[model samples]
Target: MSRSTPNTAPDGSSLPVVHVAAGVLIDMQEKVLLARRSADSHQGGLWEFPGGKLEPGEQNRDALCRELEEELGIQVRRARPLIRVTHRYPDRAVILHTWLVTSWEGDPRGREGQPLSWMPVAELPHWPMPAADIPILRALDLPDTYLITPPGFKETALFLRQLQQALDKGISLLQFRLFGLPASGHEVLARQACRLCEEYGARMLLNGPLKLARAVGAHGVHLDRRSLMALNDRNGYEGLLLGASCHDALELEQAQAVGVDFAVLSPVLPTLSHPDAEILGWEGFSQLSQGISIPVYALGGMAPDLLEQSWKQGGQGIAGIRGLWPSSV
Candidate 1:
């Protein structure tokens, strides 16, 4: 077994330790190599990406070359580091260092006694994988700018009246993320919200509850980072849009790889809610969005006025809590 070690996060926390390594076994078609874990190991009998621990003082490229050979028996000539994923399990955590490896030498063989599967990019969700891997899967499948709900003032009777007034004023897409409501009340509210959205020819994403989304006949699902990480078969929930919230380059890359229609990149600006958290300025946003084929919306402290600026800076659109929720058109 590969020796485990403590891995520090960017924030200097040790709560979620990861074994940093890279997996670079992809082709032109964007299909990637997947390996099932042997039933003997931790999270055994489950599917996992192939890679291992990075040695000290080793750069990503060198580590990938070493780990691929050690784990998969394949020699890599060139590999491109694409994404990084940190997964927290019950006992331990692992940081999956992913790379878009287009070229390699020799056919990959599972020398580790685990079964191998060649998965197309679009079909990646079929296999059971670690929870953290889900965002990557959705990102691989989706595009940008999915509708967030309650486009105008939220649906208090008065708020609902105001929202109705704003619909014709041009709030086209929305997601109903109403929390704290009883299930029965939620059903009624969701139906009402859905009707309003539909009347406007807008789309709606149900937050936190796929079953509720299905029950409410929503146009899609807005997966929080947790939900995105936990989902294995996004394709199984047919006809519903799959969207995710992303906070970093790694999450964005995974979202794109998994084919999520669009993703929200949040905390572009610091907020009162999370004052301690660092905000990724436009420059950081640019770095993350560059070369990504999917559309990225600037989330956190963004407003409708910021849309034009965001687009000029390569963002698809803007997403916000207070900025996009008011009754004003």
Candidate 2:
């Protein structure tokens, strides 16, 4: 989700898109499998998820199963869509459809005479992987649910109680977004929230200025569109998870240029809170995934039940306030 450019050729003409299917196969101890590309082949010497180019009209799932058997000698028992990366090189553009192979039969080895390795999931980021395969690592790290804090808290004590309840229910990622609050109020609230998140092993992203997000000890900073644009150098934000609110391809590109870790695409469906807001509908939501290489969460009108549907349409997960918040509380 960090870097990307427009998918066009040197002459500014559109390039033919190549479709490939890849799989993230994990061992019993939960290490991810990666294959090294042949030294003479494209992106040689770099490790990648096991996969290959898809034949015309071949379904992604079918290609994954066929490729896994051919390349690894394993039968995929269960698999699900993980992420789709659309990357462009000077000569070609590629749409890499990745799947999570949860269960399989037979051991995985390099049948194509290439080397294979298994590494801890956290160590994947340090491996020399192709730019397109980096998003797959981020997808593997993200959870299935994201929680946004309630906008207004009438009583601070009551809000902390609700926040603790949500944490206890196992919501590990949260956004502390409160409108109409002064700087002093934010500082006080953020410290208390940070303590609770630490106790429960959850991460809290402050939805405010970066300075305050750091001073208050937040795990990350979640930027709205304007703040996302203001960011230039990413050096100051090292080790903090940077997320953004993106609505269109342009914003997504900007988010990538600014080194954002993830994004939340909103208004996937209508909401009572903002009745007049335009909804993306599922089809529109899917289109946002076309050009970007980041983990995106469906944000408006989202609930637990819609998690699978969001995944099918190429989302990292679902993020919400009313729908997800009240339930956990």
Candidate 3:
């Protein structure tokens, strides 16, 4: 197994990080279990997924099963990786390995005498939680596949027709990346695409300027690495969903620092378009993403069928251009 490198502190010192295995136990009603940390513990009083530190030589799944049994008094019968978050606090860093416990024996109780509750998924954001849990919520809200538009289609009518077909087939999250088009043309197509997406109750993100995204009434903007690096802060994007394209760990860190809602980490495999680009195999991707506290989509050479693989490797989902766009169209 690959291990993540320690994070550097502000003064250029390495920070010791504890790896924790946590579980999101969802009941039949779809409400998720949350536990409040003890007042004297680190990040005390914050609501968190019930879990504990991984014991030496313990596998993540075994650790989760052990923690759930000990902390919640439930034996995990079935579970899977949901998300992994790495958060840096002033004193120490933590790598939170979160699992979705689908089935368990016995009912959950606060075996450790901690405060516990099962909150509706919709209400999760309103509750105060540890900083690391934010991305877990976001991951839960997103779909398994994110579609990006290719620049091949030159006509707006043709593009919209294809997009409608895709939406009809249940592609809910889309990125309108009309690169190299004239400003006027791009805006016109974007507005139409946004309207089309709204009609389907889907979300459309413009892969261009923030102003263009807003002007066209897009749900958000998808920034390239250049734009991500150029941004000074996340103030103006408060009302919108922000996503960034990242190629490496440094760029992923930058994206997280700027408060983007999610990120697309690319070249997880060799791609037809960028065939020569360096690939981050599943191991490398997992290692690089270990401490990231944001939903990351595996972007290069991905298809809907790869969603399961992506999840196992700690990705929220898979994102692609060619793979999602039907060749028959």
Candidate 4:
């Protein structure tokens, strides 16, 4: 009998782990650079982001820079960590340290005789891509911040005014997080919120109870931790975009297993809302996110300034109530 370990083959041999650093070069037109893989290599005929494997004792940034210079005749001037993904094939496993390169020195010529294309993010889906690269696509599609509506929605006009302000300030993703409203109150408020979100071209999610999301024509539903755990039958979980609030690795694993569109992992930093709560910090957050296949947002104490920090720490973005809400509101 063959027993397969997490990182071991059925034959009792360790699977080789390949460490790669890939770069997504963005142009002013909101397109990302993709190079066609060699017909002789693995995942041939598929388009991919440019990068190479890391050498022994080498850093990810160093490997990324060196590979870009060698393969594309360019030097990365500005780059930010986007996502880290670990995937296993039949023969081996791979860990990708992906970065978004906004600025570079030279024109990116395919020095390796590879073909390159500047493809829009929306169009990239139509092209066949490696399974390992799919997570990167998800990250690119998601916004850098998620807004949770402030707690005082009982003042309906004031809440709408504040929400409009937040949207005008460039919040493309939102969650209507106000709680304790009557069903009738919820229906009324949700319809108004949906209109505002539509005007701003933003996607809005209702917090939990899938029926409410459908009734109000929300773009998605975000399940609280309790609701996430209570789900038993997978039979009725489709047709709408879904998200979940995850506190630890177990909840995060379940979030992915149940096919959430994204997740919010909270308490990454100390915050006024949960003053004494244990914080995950960057290390803990990264450890949790690295295993997650879907987009994961950092929640506690996040702000505009911390957006890049969240990206570098293996997050899809930052999600928060106070951190994202307008101070005037």
Q: CA RMSD for every model? A: 10.8, 3.7, 2.9, 4.2
What C-alpha lDDT does candidate 4 achieve relative to the native structure?
Answer: 0.85
- Of 1 and 2, which scores higher on lDDT? 2
Q: How does model 4 score by TM-score? A: 0.91
Backbone clash pairs for candidate 2 read none
Evaluated at residue 152, the lDDT of candidate 3 is 64
Clashes of 4: 0
Q: Runs in model 2 with CA error above 4 Å?
A: 1-16, 233-235, 327-329
- Model 1 per-residue lDDT at 115: 86
In model 4, state the lDDT of residue 319: 91
By summed lDDT, the worst window of 10 consecutive residues in model 2 runs over 1-10
lDDT of 4 at 100: 88
Candidate 2, residues 120-231, lDDT tens digits: the string is 9989999999887877888898787989998997788888989888887899999999988887987999989988998998999999877888898999999999988778
- Per-residue lDDT of candidate 3, residues 269-323 (tens digit): 9899998899998888776665477889898889878888888988888999989
In order, candidate lDDTs are 0.68, 0.85, 0.86, 0.85
TM-score of each: 0.53, 0.91, 0.88, 0.91
Query: How many residue pairs clash in each candidate at the backbone level?
Result: 25, 0, 0, 0
